[model samples]
Target: MSVDAERPAPLMHAWRHPAPKGAAGRCIGARTDLPVDRRKAKRLAHRIRAIARREGLPRAVATSPLARCRDVGRWLRRFGFRHVVDAQLAELDFGRWDGRCWEAIDAAEIAAWSADLVGHAPGGGESVRVLLSRVRAVHARAPAALLVTHGGWLSAAVWLALGEAHAPTAATWPKAPGYGRRVILWRLQAPALHRPSDR
Candidate 1:
């Protein structure tokens, strides 16, 4: 069957940038524009495109509000997914912590909030719940999707999928969005089911 843009299959995929050596963050002074090793971009892109093609995610488009993400989208455009959207997938606007590194951010407040990460941000950023809500909104829009979002976004998605908890860490959030672990395994269902232990 031929893949058509208007009626592509539904799927959610998470892809990470190669690494944060010399990309978006601009922390690295001067290096190749590619977030990942340029020598390997072709190979990586080729591999990703193959998977997308194989999975029938021909419309395997991406959504993100970050320029870096868009830049990555542009790179992957040729893989039959020229459609990349900017959907506020960036880390919750730290509001105050946008540019400051972790060390530069207020430590005492950071420490206070770190104790309970789900509900607070160190420098008045978004809480995990809020972030999950926003990302879930995006998730709700499509039956299948491929988000070029940060690690935090992935973590929340994982939580929503499994209804379980995992350790959150500084490295949890991506400096630049990359391929997320492809594990949106369960089919979407409503909250109407009565659990066996619902007492």
Candidate 2:
């Protein structure tokens, strides 16, 4: 085996940003950029700091540029952690469908996306394949990084970590981690295949 293959994967701890205001029942994506309550953001930041302190992880964090995720990173920065804002960590871009109520979108458009899960770009925005590629790049660049990101991004990371063989259909795609929830992506013994999955 190659040395790179023999090396263990780095650990990554990712937390979904706190739920944004006015996001309930809405198709909030990269373009939405909704705000999260400050208190909730601070609470999550404190939790991250406590975990880092307890586990001896680095005092550094990365977050999406969106307010919901960035707000948490800001709190971490105030607590003395090195904060990095990475656009790659942002949520899937939904294009025209962004920030609209679920019921407002056309059924046929939704079906079209579900039919091609991997290649179809909902709202004419980024495809699932593209999002997976971006997530993989982020992992490759900073395998052990701590992240504050969106649910869709977290789902992609989880899909990659699981070594799934096929692209996820609507039925197989794992649900998004709850807001403010932390998911630890352990380095797999073998490299994971990059495949498409939903946000």
Candidate 3:
């Protein structure tokens, strides 16, 4: 599919939330609600402003309900953009292992997660398929919007958008978009309709 320049572009910019204050090397998933690092939040706010200037303001600023994203949403709200919290944008629930350190988790369970990336739920949390469903739903509802969400959520969305043929192995499928990074994914617009005389 090719994009028609004549039509307004439908763009979705997914910005991974910056690392929350002191949330280093921990299993911080949907259940974890860490606050944004104060210094990092300042930097992120500036970048968001730059993005707004370049993109000419998003249709809406959407974020995961988690504090990491919600804090960023708060910053955006203060900046004058309409912010909305969508649970669909929340990170994958890590269940029992939500806030546990990676080293503290069972090695065998981590291996299980790797063996069946899509189906295995780390600490009995949401599966990859479930996360993808929610992410896709959000995209379908708001094709053109700015989203602040988790790395896991963003990775799943990218993998799904790439389609099954380009699907990667369990070891390589979902990849975290580095904190504070901005990724813009676009869908090509359908061809314009032409009148009989024009054709």
Each candidate structure's TM-score, on Cα atoms with residue i matched to residue i, is 0.66, 0.90, 0.84
Tens-place lDDT per residue, model 1, 105-162, is: 5677767666777777545656776776876777677556655555556555655554
Q: Rate the local accuracy (lDDT) of all candidates.
A: 0.50, 0.85, 0.74
RMSD each, Å: 9.0, 5.2, 7.5
lDDT of 2: 0.85
Tens digit per residue, CA lDDT, model 2, 72-176: 999999999999999999999999999999999999999999999889999999998898898888877886788899989988787777777778888776678
What's model 2's TM-score? 0.90
lDDT of 3 by residue, 34-147 (tens): 887776766776687776787586635888898888888788788887889999999889889899999999999989888888777879999887887887788778877888
**Poorest lDDT segment (10 consecutive residues) of candidate 2:** 190-199
lDDT of the structure predicted as candidate 1: 0.50
